[model samples]
Target: MNEVLVSEKLVVRVPCAVIEYNGKVLAGQRSAALSFPLKWEFPGGKAEKNESDEDALYREIKEELDVDIEIIQKLPVTSKDQGWREIILVPFICRLKTLQITLTEHEQILWLGPEELSSLDWTEADLNVIENYYEYLSVKK
Candidate 1:
């Protein structure tokens, strides 16, 4: 017989930003070296030690895309159970201060509308965020 273990863990607050321009949201394709490589996700990263969520968002956007963002709204937390590692993502609705995006951590990037989101192969963590955003948009309309 094989023994199995199950553990419950507290959720982490990882800040994410939804950058939209001309009615399309920005999504980056993770590098092949990453765990979920080639998957599309919003341009943001984990909150640094001793950094506020807002500060983390600003730094992440600037480092990853080389663009400044003005946070418009603090969106809800997007959670996902990844079996091994769980995640709690805080997504913010933001506007880009510049049009150019320089990919530093990602392999490629896409600016997609709501319809395009469903078609892309997103990471499990990102899929939850996408679904929640879709529901949010539906409710707003």
Candidate 2:
């Protein structure tokens, strides 16, 4: 399992994922080189040391998706064990001004509607939020 060492205390990373919706949510397929190869996940990454959540979100999206995002709202944080320390993930709902996304780290990307999202084989960490978002969409419709 991947572990991050912080100041003599091993601290797992806090990754923030963004749900970018324009009638659909964006999901990225992990590259073959990555641990969760081919599994779909929301676009984001680890929060840098001393960086704020919003800044980390922006930096991650720009690095991974190559697009700027406007954070709509932050969702609840979730924790999962990665065989090491527990990883805390914070998900955000965001709006993408440009639909054009250039994937730098992922193999493929999909823009999925709520129903489609529920049917997909998502990463374990993303499953709960995916279900929540699907429910939210069902209610909205």
lDDT of every predicted structure (CA atoms): 0.84, 0.77
- Find the candidate with the highest TM-score and give its number: 1
lDDT of 1 at 120: 85
Q: Candidate 2 residues 1-141, lDDT tens each?
A: 999875543555555565656677888888989877888888788888898888998899889888888887777777777665666777888898666788899998888876688677778888877766666556658
Off by over 4 Å in 1: 1-12
Tens-place lDDT per residue, model 1, 1-141, is 999886777556678888878999888888999978788888788887898999999999999989999998877787887666668788888999987888899999888987898788887777878877887788879
TM-scores for every candidate against the unseen true structure = 0.86, 0.83
User: At residue 139, what lDDT does model 1 achieve?
Assistant: 81
